[model samples]
Target: METLANLESFVRSAETGSFSAAGRRLALTPAAVSRNVAMLERNLGVRLFQRSTRKLTLTEAGERFLASIGGNLDALQAAIAAMSNDHGEPAGVLKVSLAPSFGVAYVMPLLPDFLQRYPAIRPEWHFENRAIDLIAEGFDAAIGGGFELAPGLVSRPLAPAHIVAVASPAYLRERTLPADPAMLNVMDGIVMRSGRTGRTRHWTMRDAAGNEVATTMRERIVVSDPAAMREAALLGLGVALLAVPDVLPWIERGELVRVLPRWYADAGAISLYYPTRTLMPGKTRAFIDHVVEAFRRDGLAQRLAGSLGL
Candidate 1:
Protein backbone atom coordinates (compact mmCIF):
# COMPACT_ATOMS: atom_id res chain seq x y z
CA MET A 1 0.00 0.00 0.00
CA GLU A 2 1.15 3.53 -0.71
CA THR A 3 2.05 5.74 2.24
CA LEU A 4 -0.87 7.53 3.90
CA ALA A 5 1.18 10.74 3.87
CA ASN A 6 1.47 10.62 0.09
CA LEU A 7 -2.26 10.00 -0.27
CA GLU A 8 -3.02 12.94 2.01
CA SER A 9 -0.72 15.27 0.08
CA PHE A 10 -2.33 14.21 -3.17
CA VAL A 11 -5.84 14.77 -1.85
CA ARG A 12 -5.16 18.12 -0.18
CA SER A 13 -3.27 19.49 -3.18
CA ALA A 14 -6.12 18.39 -5.44
CA GLU A 15 -8.76 20.05 -3.24
CA THR A 16 -6.93 23.38 -2.79
CA GLY A 17 -5.75 23.64 -6.42
CA SER A 18 -2.22 24.51 -5.30
CA PHE A 19 0.55 22.85 -3.35
CA SER A 20 1.24 26.06 -1.41
CA ALA A 21 -2.34 26.25 -0.13
CA ALA A 22 -2.39 22.54 0.63
CA GLY A 23 0.89 22.95 2.51
CA ARG A 24 -0.64 25.65 4.72
CA ARG A 25 -3.48 23.34 5.70
CA LEU A 26 -1.23 20.28 6.15
CA ALA A 27 1.44 22.17 8.14
CA LEU A 28 4.09 21.33 5.59
CA THR A 29 6.16 23.32 3.11
CA PRO A 30 4.97 23.66 -0.47
CA ALA A 31 8.07 21.74 -1.59
CA ALA A 32 7.20 18.94 0.81
CA VAL A 33 3.68 18.65 -0.54
CA SER A 34 4.97 18.67 -4.11
CA ARG A 35 7.51 15.96 -3.35
CA ASN A 36 4.88 13.74 -1.68
CA VAL A 37 2.51 14.21 -4.60
CA ALA A 38 5.25 13.39 -7.05
CA MET A 39 6.01 10.20 -5.13
CA LEU A 40 2.32 9.28 -5.15
CA GLU A 41 2.11 9.87 -8.91
CA ARG A 42 5.13 7.67 -9.49
CA ASN A 43 3.70 4.89 -7.38
CA LEU A 44 0.33 5.12 -9.11
CA GLY A 45 1.88 5.51 -12.61
CA VAL A 46 -0.40 8.37 -13.65
CA ARG A 47 -0.05 12.09 -14.31
CA LEU A 48 -2.36 13.47 -11.62
CA PHE A 49 -2.13 17.16 -12.27
CA GLN A 50 -1.06 19.69 -14.89
CA ARG A 51 1.17 22.18 -13.08
CA SER A 52 1.75 25.76 -14.17
CA THR A 53 3.10 28.82 -12.38
CA ARG A 54 -0.34 30.43 -12.27
CA LYS A 55 -2.60 27.43 -11.63
CA LEU A 56 -2.92 23.68 -11.14
CA THR A 57 -5.45 21.64 -13.07
CA LEU A 58 -6.37 18.04 -12.44
CA THR A 59 -5.57 15.64 -15.26
CA GLU A 60 -8.24 13.21 -16.58
CA ALA A 61 -6.52 10.43 -14.65
CA GLY A 62 -6.38 12.59 -11.57
CA GLU A 63 -10.11 13.33 -11.73
CA ARG A 64 -10.89 9.66 -12.01
CA PHE A 65 -8.52 8.84 -9.17
CA LEU A 66 -10.05 11.47 -6.89
CA ALA A 67 -13.57 10.25 -7.63
CA SER A 68 -12.59 6.77 -6.55
CA ILE A 69 -10.72 7.81 -3.38
CA GLY A 70 -12.52 10.93 -2.17
CA GLY A 71 -15.45 9.13 -0.61
CA ASN A 72 -13.29 6.84 1.51
CA LEU A 73 -10.61 9.31 2.63
CA ASP A 74 -12.66 10.49 5.63
CA ALA A 75 -13.22 6.91 6.76
CA LEU A 76 -9.53 6.17 6.44
CA GLN A 77 -8.57 9.24 8.45
CA ALA A 78 -11.10 8.39 11.16
CA ALA A 79 -9.78 4.84 11.37
CA ILE A 80 -6.20 6.06 11.67
CA ALA A 81 -7.15 8.61 14.32
CA ALA A 82 -9.13 6.03 16.33
CA MET A 83 -6.14 3.68 16.25
CA SER A 84 -3.78 6.43 17.39
CA ASN A 85 -5.54 7.47 20.59
CA ASP A 86 -8.66 7.31 22.77
CA HIS A 87 -11.70 6.96 20.51
CA GLY A 88 -14.31 8.03 23.10
CA GLU A 89 -12.99 11.54 23.66
CA PRO A 90 -12.56 13.86 20.69
CA ALA A 91 -9.14 15.48 20.65
CA GLY A 92 -7.88 17.54 17.72
CA VAL A 93 -7.84 21.01 16.20
CA LEU A 94 -11.44 21.87 15.42
CA LYS A 95 -11.09 24.36 12.59
CA VAL A 96 -14.10 26.58 11.91
CA SER A 97 -14.85 29.58 9.67
CA LEU A 98 -17.25 32.36 10.66
CA ALA A 99 -18.58 35.71 9.56
CA PRO A 100 -16.77 38.12 11.86
CA SER A 101 -19.43 40.57 13.06
CA PHE A 102 -22.18 38.05 13.63
CA GLY A 103 -19.88 35.37 15.03
CA VAL A 104 -18.29 37.72 17.50
CA ALA A 105 -21.60 39.23 18.56
CA TYR A 106 -23.34 35.89 19.00
CA VAL A 107 -21.36 32.65 18.74
CA MET A 108 -18.09 33.65 20.38
CA PRO A 109 -19.84 34.10 23.71
CA LEU A 110 -20.85 30.42 23.68
CA LEU A 111 -17.23 29.28 23.41
CA PRO A 112 -16.52 29.39 27.14
CA ASP A 113 -19.32 26.94 27.90
CA PHE A 114 -18.48 24.73 24.94
CA LEU A 115 -14.80 24.58 25.84
CA GLN A 116 -15.67 23.72 29.41
CA ARG A 117 -17.71 20.76 28.18
CA TYR A 118 -15.25 19.51 25.57
CA PRO A 119 -11.89 20.44 27.02
CA ALA A 120 -10.02 17.98 24.85
CA ILE A 121 -11.18 19.69 21.65
CA ARG A 122 -9.21 22.81 20.76
CA PRO A 123 -10.84 25.34 18.50
CA GLU A 124 -9.07 27.09 15.65
CA TRP A 125 -11.56 29.73 14.63
CA HIS A 126 -11.26 32.10 11.66
CA PHE A 127 -13.37 35.27 11.56
CA GLU A 128 -13.89 36.76 8.12
CA ASN A 129 -16.56 37.68 5.55
CA ARG A 130 -15.49 35.51 2.65
CA ALA A 131 -17.11 32.20 1.74
CA ILE A 132 -14.55 29.43 2.31
CA ASP A 133 -14.29 26.04 0.64
CA LEU A 134 -14.67 23.98 3.83
CA ILE A 135 -13.19 20.67 2.59
CA ALA A 136 -10.58 22.30 0.35
CA GLU A 137 -9.39 24.59 3.14
CA GLY A 138 -9.59 21.84 5.79
CA PHE A 139 -12.21 23.66 7.87
CA ASP A 140 -14.30 21.39 10.12
CA ALA A 141 -17.31 23.72 9.94
CA ALA A 142 -18.53 27.21 9.01
CA ILE A 143 -21.26 29.61 10.20
CA GLY A 144 -22.78 32.14 7.82
CA GLY A 145 -25.16 32.55 4.92
CA GLY A 146 -25.24 33.06 1.12
CA PHE A 147 -22.54 30.47 0.40
CA GLU A 148 -23.31 28.21 -2.53
CA LEU A 149 -23.58 24.65 -1.18
CA ALA A 150 -20.84 22.61 -2.84
CA PRO A 151 -20.95 18.83 -3.24
CA GLY A 152 -20.43 16.62 -0.17
CA LEU A 153 -21.41 19.43 2.19
CA VAL A 154 -24.65 20.07 4.10
CA SER A 155 -26.21 23.11 5.84
CA ARG A 156 -28.56 23.30 8.82
CA PRO A 157 -30.72 26.37 9.33
CA LEU A 158 -29.71 28.60 12.22
CA ALA A 159 -31.64 31.85 11.83
CA PRO A 160 -32.93 34.33 9.31
CA ALA A 161 -30.22 36.56 7.83
CA HIS A 162 -32.14 39.79 8.36
CA ILE A 163 -30.99 43.31 7.47
CA VAL A 164 -32.71 46.46 8.62
CA ALA A 165 -32.17 50.18 8.17
CA VAL A 166 -30.56 51.91 11.14
CA ALA A 167 -28.91 55.19 12.05
CA SER A 168 -27.49 56.88 15.12
CA PRO A 169 -29.94 58.85 17.28
CA ALA A 170 -27.76 61.92 16.83
CA TYR A 171 -27.84 61.65 13.03
CA LEU A 172 -31.62 61.60 12.87
CA ARG A 173 -32.06 64.58 15.22
CA GLU A 174 -33.42 66.92 12.56
CA ARG A 175 -33.90 64.52 9.63
CA THR A 176 -37.40 63.27 9.01
CA LEU A 177 -37.72 59.48 9.13
CA PRO A 178 -39.13 57.76 6.08
CA ALA A 179 -42.53 56.11 6.41
CA ASP A 180 -42.00 53.63 3.56
CA PRO A 181 -39.14 51.87 1.73
CA ALA A 182 -39.69 53.94 -1.41
CA MET A 183 -39.10 57.09 0.61
CA LEU A 184 -35.56 55.86 1.45
CA ASN A 185 -34.51 56.82 -2.07
CA VAL A 186 -33.92 60.41 -0.90
CA MET A 187 -31.94 59.52 2.25
CA ASP A 188 -28.20 59.40 2.61
CA GLY A 189 -27.38 55.69 2.74
CA ILE A 190 -24.38 53.86 4.05
CA VAL A 191 -24.01 50.61 2.13
CA MET A 192 -21.72 47.60 1.80
CA ARG A 193 -20.02 46.55 -1.40
CA SER A 194 -20.28 42.79 -1.79
CA GLY A 195 -16.98 41.13 -0.94
CA ARG A 196 -17.50 38.47 -3.61
CA THR A 197 -19.17 40.52 -6.34
CA GLY A 198 -17.62 43.94 -5.59
CA ARG A 199 -21.02 45.57 -6.22
CA THR A 200 -23.18 47.57 -3.84
CA ARG A 201 -26.09 45.39 -2.67
CA HIS A 202 -29.63 46.67 -3.02
CA TRP A 203 -32.26 46.08 -0.37
CA THR A 204 -35.66 44.39 -0.49
CA MET A 205 -37.58 45.60 2.52
CA ARG A 206 -40.60 43.83 4.07
CA ASP A 207 -42.93 44.70 6.92
CA ALA A 208 -44.44 42.60 9.70
CA ALA A 209 -47.65 42.73 7.62
CA GLY A 210 -45.82 41.04 4.68
CA ASN A 211 -45.61 44.09 2.43
CA GLU A 212 -42.47 44.06 0.27
CA VAL A 213 -40.62 46.99 -1.22
CA ALA A 214 -37.29 47.00 -3.02
CA THR A 215 -35.32 50.21 -2.70
CA THR A 216 -31.99 51.68 -3.77
CA MET A 217 -30.59 54.86 -2.27
CA ARG A 218 -27.74 57.28 -2.87
CA GLU A 219 -24.79 55.94 -0.89
CA ARG A 220 -22.94 58.44 1.27
CA ILE A 221 -20.19 55.97 2.09
CA VAL A 222 -19.56 52.47 0.79
CA VAL A 223 -17.71 49.98 2.99
CA SER A 224 -16.64 46.41 2.36
CA ASP A 225 -17.28 45.26 5.92
CA PRO A 226 -20.45 45.31 7.99
CA ALA A 227 -18.68 46.58 11.12
CA ALA A 228 -17.39 49.56 9.21
CA MET A 229 -20.85 50.36 7.93
CA ARG A 230 -22.14 50.35 11.52
CA GLU A 231 -19.34 52.71 12.51
CA ALA A 232 -20.20 55.04 9.66
CA ALA A 233 -23.84 55.09 10.72
CA LEU A 234 -22.75 55.72 14.31
CA LEU A 235 -20.76 58.72 13.16
CA GLY A 236 -24.05 60.26 12.04
CA LEU A 237 -22.96 59.97 8.42
CA GLY A 238 -25.97 58.19 6.87
CA VAL A 239 -28.55 55.47 7.22
CA ALA A 240 -27.09 51.98 6.80
CA LEU A 241 -28.63 48.68 5.89
CA LEU A 242 -27.14 46.12 8.22
CA ALA A 243 -27.65 42.69 9.74
CA VAL A 244 -29.80 42.94 12.87
CA PRO A 245 -27.46 40.71 14.85
CA ASP A 246 -24.47 42.92 14.08
CA VAL A 247 -26.19 46.11 15.28
CA LEU A 248 -28.44 44.72 18.01
CA PRO A 249 -26.12 45.75 20.83
CA TRP A 250 -25.79 49.29 19.52
CA ILE A 251 -29.53 49.62 19.14
CA GLU A 252 -30.14 48.26 22.64
CA ARG A 253 -27.67 50.76 24.10
CA GLY A 254 -29.66 53.59 22.53
CA GLU A 255 -26.64 54.70 20.50
CA LEU A 256 -28.46 53.77 17.29
CA VAL A 257 -32.13 53.92 16.29
CA ARG A 258 -34.10 51.84 13.85
CA VAL A 259 -35.20 53.79 10.79
CA LEU A 260 -38.23 51.72 9.83
CA PRO A 261 -39.29 49.48 12.70
CA ARG A 262 -41.29 46.85 10.88
CA TRP A 263 -39.33 46.83 7.63
CA TYR A 264 -36.42 44.39 7.12
CA ALA A 265 -34.66 42.71 4.25
CA ASP A 266 -34.81 38.95 4.14
CA ALA A 267 -31.25 38.00 3.24
CA GLY A 268 -31.83 34.25 3.63
CA ALA A 269 -31.21 31.90 6.53
CA ILE A 270 -27.83 31.74 8.19
CA SER A 271 -26.65 28.15 8.61
CA LEU A 272 -24.07 25.86 10.10
CA TYR A 273 -22.35 24.01 7.28
CA TYR A 274 -20.11 20.95 7.29
CA PRO A 275 -18.98 18.07 5.16
CA THR A 276 -21.26 15.00 5.05
CA ARG A 277 -19.39 12.07 6.52
CA THR A 278 -20.39 8.66 7.88
CA LEU A 279 -18.13 9.04 10.92
CA MET A 280 -17.80 12.72 11.79
CA PRO A 281 -15.06 13.87 14.12
CA GLY A 282 -16.31 14.12 17.69
CA LYS A 283 -15.23 17.73 18.13
CA THR A 284 -17.27 18.78 15.11
CA ARG A 285 -20.31 16.79 16.22
CA ALA A 286 -20.18 18.22 19.72
CA PHE A 287 -19.94 21.78 18.46
CA ILE A 288 -22.93 21.34 16.13
CA ASP A 289 -25.02 19.80 18.88
CA HIS A 290 -24.10 22.39 21.49
CA VAL A 291 -24.67 25.36 19.20
CA VAL A 292 -27.93 24.05 17.80
CA GLU A 293 -29.22 23.38 21.29
CA ALA A 294 -28.15 26.79 22.55
CA PHE A 295 -29.86 28.54 19.66
CA ARG A 296 -33.01 26.57 20.26
CA ARG A 297 -33.03 27.35 23.99
CA ASP A 298 -32.50 31.07 23.45
CA GLY A 299 -34.99 31.32 20.58
CA LEU A 300 -32.24 32.71 18.35
CA ALA A 301 -34.44 32.78 15.29
CA GLN A 302 -36.99 35.12 16.87
CA ARG A 303 -34.29 37.13 18.67
CA LEU A 304 -32.43 37.65 15.43
CA ALA A 305 -35.71 38.83 13.97
CA GLY A 306 -35.89 41.52 16.71
CA SER A 307 -39.04 39.89 18.16
CA LEU A 308 -38.46 41.19 21.70
CA GLY A 309 -40.04 44.46 20.52
CA LEU A 310 -36.74 46.03 19.60
Candidate 2:
Protein backbone atom coordinates (compact mmCIF):
# COMPACT_ATOMS: atom_id res chain seq x y z
CA MET A 1 0.00 0.00 0.00
CA GLU A 2 1.21 3.53 -0.80
CA THR A 3 1.78 5.92 2.07
CA LEU A 4 -1.11 8.28 2.82
CA ALA A 5 1.23 11.24 2.33
CA ASN A 6 2.07 10.10 -1.17
CA LEU A 7 -1.57 9.61 -2.10
CA GLU A 8 -2.55 12.95 -0.55
CA SER A 9 0.21 14.74 -2.45
CA PHE A 10 -0.88 13.27 -5.74
CA VAL A 11 -4.55 14.11 -5.15
CA ARG A 12 -3.86 17.67 -4.05
CA SER A 13 -1.46 18.27 -6.94
CA ALA A 14 -4.05 16.99 -9.39
CA GLU A 15 -6.76 19.21 -7.88
CA THR A 16 -4.61 22.35 -7.81
CA GLY A 17 -2.65 21.61 -11.02
CA SER A 18 0.63 22.48 -9.27
CA PHE A 19 2.98 21.01 -6.71
CA SER A 20 3.43 24.36 -5.00
CA ALA A 21 -0.29 24.71 -4.36
CA ALA A 22 -0.51 21.14 -3.07
CA GLY A 23 2.45 21.78 -0.81
CA ARG A 24 0.70 24.82 0.60
CA ARG A 25 -2.35 22.77 1.51
CA LEU A 26 -0.36 19.94 3.02
CA ALA A 27 2.12 22.18 4.86
CA LEU A 28 5.00 20.64 2.90
CA THR A 29 7.64 22.17 0.66
CA PRO A 30 7.02 22.05 -3.08
CA ALA A 31 10.01 19.76 -3.47
CA ALA A 32 8.63 17.49 -0.77
CA VAL A 33 5.28 17.29 -2.52
CA SER A 34 6.95 16.56 -5.84
CA ARG A 35 9.04 13.81 -4.28
CA ASN A 36 5.96 12.20 -2.73
CA VAL A 37 4.16 12.17 -6.07
CA ALA A 38 7.23 10.64 -7.72
CA MET A 39 7.43 7.96 -5.05
CA LEU A 40 3.76 7.19 -5.55
CA GLU A 41 4.33 6.84 -9.30
CA ARG A 42 7.29 4.52 -8.69
CA ASN A 43 5.27 2.34 -6.31
CA LEU A 44 2.44 2.04 -8.85
CA GLY A 45 4.78 1.62 -11.80
CA VAL A 46 2.74 4.04 -13.94
CA ARG A 47 3.33 7.51 -15.36
CA LEU A 48 0.65 9.49 -13.59
CA PHE A 49 1.26 13.10 -14.51
CA GLN A 50 2.86 14.97 -17.36
CA ARG A 51 4.91 17.55 -15.46
CA SER A 52 5.71 20.91 -17.01
CA THR A 53 7.25 24.12 -15.78
CA ARG A 54 3.88 25.79 -15.26
CA LYS A 55 1.50 22.97 -14.34
CA LEU A 56 0.89 19.23 -13.98
CA THR A 57 -1.57 17.51 -16.29
CA LEU A 58 -2.68 14.01 -15.47
CA THR A 59 -2.28 11.16 -17.96
CA GLU A 60 -5.13 8.75 -18.80
CA ALA A 61 -3.98 6.29 -16.17
CA GLY A 62 -3.64 9.11 -13.66
CA GLU A 63 -7.17 10.31 -14.35
CA ARG A 64 -8.55 6.83 -13.86
CA PHE A 65 -6.60 6.41 -10.67
CA LEU A 66 -7.76 9.81 -9.35
CA ALA A 67 -11.40 9.01 -10.08
CA SER A 68 -11.02 5.68 -8.33
CA ILE A 69 -9.41 7.05 -5.19
CA GLY A 70 -10.91 10.53 -4.78
CA GLY A 71 -13.91 9.47 -2.69
CA ASN A 72 -11.84 6.92 -0.82
CA LEU A 73 -9.33 9.58 0.18
CA ASP A 74 -12.04 11.72 1.73
CA ALA A 75 -13.41 8.75 3.62
CA LEU A 76 -9.97 7.69 4.77
CA GLN A 77 -9.16 11.18 5.98
CA ALA A 78 -12.42 11.32 7.87
CA ALA A 79 -11.66 8.02 9.56
CA ILE A 80 -8.20 9.20 10.53
CA ALA A 81 -9.63 12.43 11.92
CA ALA A 82 -12.12 10.46 13.99
CA MET A 83 -9.41 8.23 15.37
CA SER A 84 -7.12 11.18 16.07
CA ASN A 85 -9.86 12.96 17.96
CA ASP A 86 -10.17 9.98 20.25
CA HIS A 87 -6.46 9.95 21.00
CA GLY A 88 -5.35 13.62 20.89
CA GLU A 89 -6.40 17.21 21.18
CA PRO A 90 -7.16 19.33 18.14
CA ALA A 91 -3.77 20.73 17.12
CA GLY A 92 -2.34 22.11 13.89
CA VAL A 93 -1.63 25.30 11.98
CA LEU A 94 -5.00 26.79 11.19
CA LYS A 95 -4.73 28.69 7.93
CA VAL A 96 -7.50 31.12 7.16
CA SER A 97 -8.18 34.08 4.84
CA LEU A 98 -10.29 37.11 5.61
CA ALA A 99 -10.86 40.72 4.64
CA PRO A 100 -8.29 42.99 6.25
CA SER A 101 -10.55 45.62 7.76
CA PHE A 102 -13.29 43.31 8.95
CA GLY A 103 -10.93 40.66 10.19
CA VAL A 104 -8.88 43.13 12.23
CA ALA A 105 -11.92 44.81 13.72
CA TYR A 106 -14.01 41.75 14.55
CA VAL A 107 -12.21 38.39 14.25
CA MET A 108 -8.85 39.45 15.61
CA PRO A 109 -10.35 40.19 18.98
CA LEU A 110 -11.29 36.53 19.36
CA LEU A 111 -7.71 35.35 19.03
CA PRO A 112 -6.79 35.50 22.71
CA ASP A 113 -9.74 33.37 23.71
CA PHE A 114 -9.27 30.97 20.85
CA LEU A 115 -5.65 30.47 21.79
CA GLN A 116 -6.56 29.92 25.38
CA ARG A 117 -8.93 27.17 24.42
CA TYR A 118 -6.85 25.50 21.72
CA PRO A 119 -3.32 25.97 22.99
CA ALA A 120 -1.82 23.50 20.56
CA ILE A 121 -3.25 25.20 17.47
CA ARG A 122 -1.36 27.95 15.69
CA PRO A 123 -3.12 30.53 13.53
CA GLU A 124 -1.91 31.44 10.06
CA TRP A 125 -4.10 34.27 8.89
CA HIS A 126 -4.00 36.08 5.53
CA PHE A 127 -5.69 39.44 5.48
CA GLU A 128 -6.67 40.19 1.90
CA ASN A 129 -9.40 42.22 0.14
CA ARG A 130 -10.39 40.01 -2.77
CA ALA A 131 -12.18 36.69 -3.07
CA ILE A 132 -9.89 33.68 -3.26
CA ASP A 133 -10.08 30.08 -4.40
CA LEU A 134 -10.07 28.27 -1.09
CA ILE A 135 -9.01 24.85 -2.37
CA ALA A 136 -6.56 26.09 -5.00
CA GLU A 137 -4.96 28.57 -2.61
CA GLY A 138 -4.91 26.00 0.23
CA PHE A 139 -6.89 28.15 2.62
CA ASP A 140 -8.50 26.05 5.36
CA ALA A 141 -11.25 28.64 5.63
CA ALA A 142 -12.20 32.14 4.52
CA ILE A 143 -14.49 34.94 5.67
CA GLY A 144 -15.91 37.75 3.53
CA GLY A 145 -18.84 38.81 1.41
CA GLY A 146 -19.66 38.40 -2.28
CA PHE A 147 -17.54 35.31 -2.85
CA GLU A 148 -18.44 33.02 -5.70
CA LEU A 149 -19.22 29.58 -4.21
CA ALA A 150 -16.89 27.27 -6.06
CA PRO A 151 -17.48 23.52 -6.16
CA GLY A 152 -17.02 21.56 -2.92
CA LEU A 153 -17.41 24.73 -0.86
CA VAL A 154 -20.12 25.76 1.56
CA SER A 155 -21.00 29.17 2.98
CA ARG A 156 -22.38 29.92 6.44
CA PRO A 157 -23.76 33.43 6.66
CA LEU A 158 -22.81 35.51 9.68
CA ALA A 159 -24.18 38.91 8.74
CA PRO A 160 -25.87 40.82 5.97
CA ALA A 161 -23.55 42.70 3.63
CA HIS A 162 -25.81 45.72 3.32
CA ILE A 163 -24.44 48.95 1.90
CA VAL A 164 -25.48 52.15 3.64
CA ALA A 165 -24.85 55.74 2.63
CA VAL A 166 -22.62 57.57 5.07
CA ALA A 167 -20.67 60.82 5.38
CA SER A 168 -18.43 62.29 8.03
CA PRO A 169 -20.14 64.67 10.43
CA ALA A 170 -17.70 67.37 9.41
CA TYR A 171 -18.51 66.90 5.75
CA LEU A 172 -22.29 66.92 6.26
CA ARG A 173 -22.23 70.04 8.40
CA GLU A 174 -22.24 72.39 5.42
CA ARG A 175 -24.14 70.13 3.02
CA THR A 176 -27.79 69.22 3.01
CA LEU A 177 -28.67 65.76 4.37
CA PRO A 178 -30.24 63.85 1.56
CA ALA A 179 -33.69 62.57 2.43
CA ASP A 180 -33.35 59.90 -0.25
CA PRO A 181 -30.71 58.17 -2.36
CA ALA A 182 -31.89 60.03 -5.51
CA MET A 183 -30.82 63.36 -4.01
CA LEU A 184 -27.25 62.00 -3.61
CA ASN A 185 -26.56 62.93 -7.23
CA VAL A 186 -26.04 66.56 -6.21
CA MET A 187 -23.52 65.65 -3.47
CA ASP A 188 -19.94 64.62 -3.89
CA GLY A 189 -19.87 60.83 -4.13
CA ILE A 190 -17.08 58.61 -2.92
CA VAL A 191 -17.75 55.56 -5.06
CA MET A 192 -16.21 52.12 -5.51
CA ARG A 193 -14.97 50.79 -8.83
CA SER A 194 -15.23 47.06 -9.28
CA GLY A 195 -11.82 45.42 -9.31
CA ARG A 196 -12.86 42.75 -11.78
CA THR A 197 -14.97 44.85 -14.17
CA GLY A 198 -13.15 48.19 -13.75
CA ARG A 199 -16.47 50.02 -13.68
CA THR A 200 -18.18 52.05 -11.03
CA ARG A 201 -20.94 50.15 -9.23
CA HIS A 202 -24.37 51.66 -8.58
CA TRP A 203 -26.91 50.19 -6.22
CA THR A 204 -30.62 50.21 -5.56
CA MET A 205 -31.64 50.99 -2.02
CA ARG A 206 -34.70 49.56 -0.28
CA ASP A 207 -36.63 50.59 2.81
CA ALA A 208 -38.65 48.65 5.38
CA ALA A 209 -41.80 50.15 3.97
CA GLY A 210 -41.18 48.18 0.75
CA ASN A 211 -40.00 51.24 -1.14
CA GLU A 212 -37.10 50.90 -3.54
CA VAL A 213 -35.14 53.55 -5.34
CA ALA A 214 -32.14 53.49 -7.63
CA THR A 215 -29.24 55.44 -6.09
CA THR A 216 -27.38 58.08 -8.12
CA MET A 217 -24.17 59.80 -7.06
CA ARG A 218 -21.80 62.38 -8.52
CA GLU A 219 -18.68 60.13 -8.37
CA ARG A 220 -16.42 62.93 -7.25
CA ILE A 221 -13.92 60.44 -5.89
CA VAL A 222 -13.52 56.86 -7.11
CA VAL A 223 -11.57 54.10 -5.39
CA SER A 224 -11.04 50.40 -5.93
CA ASP A 225 -11.07 49.57 -2.25
CA PRO A 226 -13.77 49.96 0.37
CA ALA A 227 -11.17 51.01 2.95
CA ALA A 228 -10.15 53.91 0.72
CA MET A 229 -13.76 54.93 0.25
CA ARG A 230 -14.25 54.96 4.01
CA GLU A 231 -11.12 57.00 4.52
CA ALA A 232 -12.17 59.50 1.86
CA ALA A 233 -15.55 59.89 3.52
CA LEU A 234 -13.83 60.35 6.87
CA LEU A 235 -11.73 63.16 5.40
CA GLY A 236 -14.95 64.99 4.57
CA LEU A 237 -14.47 64.36 0.87
CA GLY A 238 -17.93 63.02 0.02
CA VAL A 239 -20.76 60.66 0.85
CA ALA A 240 -19.88 57.00 0.49
CA LEU A 241 -21.69 53.70 0.22
CA LEU A 242 -20.18 51.31 2.74
CA ALA A 243 -21.03 48.03 4.38
CA VAL A 244 -22.67 48.53 7.75
CA PRO A 245 -19.90 46.69 9.60
CA ASP A 246 -17.19 48.85 7.96
CA VAL A 247 -18.73 52.14 9.11
CA LEU A 248 -20.49 51.00 12.30
CA PRO A 249 -17.62 52.04 14.54
CA TRP A 250 -17.31 55.50 13.03
CA ILE A 251 -21.06 55.98 13.10
CA GLU A 252 -21.17 55.16 16.81
CA ARG A 253 -18.18 57.46 17.47
CA GLY A 254 -20.05 60.45 16.07
CA GLU A 255 -17.37 60.78 13.37
CA LEU A 256 -19.67 59.51 10.64
CA VAL A 257 -23.42 59.72 10.17
CA ARG A 258 -25.77 57.69 8.03
CA VAL A 259 -27.03 59.87 5.19
CA LEU A 260 -30.08 57.84 4.26
CA PRO A 261 -30.95 55.86 7.40
CA ARG A 262 -34.04 54.28 5.92
CA TRP A 263 -32.37 53.15 2.75
CA TYR A 264 -29.68 50.51 2.14
CA ALA A 265 -28.55 48.30 -0.72
CA ASP A 266 -28.70 44.55 -0.25
CA ALA A 267 -25.35 43.26 -1.35
CA GLY A 268 -25.20 39.74 0.12
CA ALA A 269 -24.16 37.92 3.26
CA ILE A 270 -20.81 38.08 4.97
CA SER A 271 -20.06 34.38 5.22
CA LEU A 272 -17.72 31.76 6.62
CA TYR A 273 -16.56 29.55 3.76
CA TYR A 274 -15.04 26.07 3.92
CA PRO A 275 -14.72 23.00 1.80
CA THR A 276 -17.56 20.51 2.10
CA ARG A 277 -15.60 17.59 3.39
CA THR A 278 -17.31 14.81 5.32
CA LEU A 279 -15.02 15.52 8.25
CA MET A 280 -12.71 18.49 8.78
CA PRO A 281 -9.40 18.88 10.54
CA GLY A 282 -9.93 19.46 14.22
CA LYS A 283 -8.34 22.91 14.23
CA THR A 284 -10.49 24.13 11.37
CA ARG A 285 -13.62 22.80 13.01
CA ALA A 286 -12.75 24.50 16.28
CA PHE A 287 -12.16 27.84 14.61
CA ILE A 288 -15.42 27.70 12.70
CA ASP A 289 -17.38 26.86 15.83
CA HIS A 290 -15.67 29.60 17.80
CA VAL A 291 -16.45 32.24 15.18
CA VAL A 292 -20.04 31.14 14.81
CA GLU A 293 -20.55 31.20 18.56
CA ALA A 294 -18.96 34.62 18.87
CA PHE A 295 -21.13 36.12 16.21
CA ARG A 296 -24.22 34.78 17.89
CA ARG A 297 -23.19 35.84 21.39
CA ASP A 298 -22.40 39.38 20.26
CA GLY A 299 -25.53 39.79 18.17
CA LEU A 300 -23.34 40.84 15.27
CA ALA A 301 -25.89 39.67 12.74
CA GLN A 302 -28.49 42.12 14.03
CA ARG A 303 -26.01 44.91 14.68
CA LEU A 304 -24.52 44.62 11.22
CA ALA A 305 -27.87 44.73 9.50
CA GLY A 306 -28.25 47.86 7.34
CA SER A 307 -31.93 48.19 8.11
CA LEU A 308 -30.99 48.82 11.74
CA GLY A 309 -28.65 51.71 10.86
CA LEU A 310 -30.96 54.50 11.97
Q: Model 1: per-residue lDDT, tens digit, 3-35?
A: 888988889898889998998767578999999
Off by over 4 Å in 2: 54-70
**Deviation in Å, model 1, residue 156 alpha carbon:** 1.3
- The TM-score that candidate 1 achieves is 0.81
Clashing pairs in 2: none
Residue 30, candidate 2: C-alpha displacement in angstroms: 2.5
- lDDT (C-alpha) at residue 140 in model 1: 86
**Residue 174 lDDT, candidate 2, scale 0-100:** 86
Candidate 2 lDDT over residue span 99-172, tens digit each: 99899999999999999999999999999887687877778899998789988899999999999999988898
TM-score of each: 0.81, 0.92
| lDDT of the candidates, in the order given | 0.87, 0.91
Backbone clash pairs in model 2 (N, Cα, C under 3 Å; residues 3+ apart or in different chains), count: 0
RMSD vs true structure, all candidates? 3.8, 2.1
Tell me the deviation in Å of residue 262 in model 1. 1.0
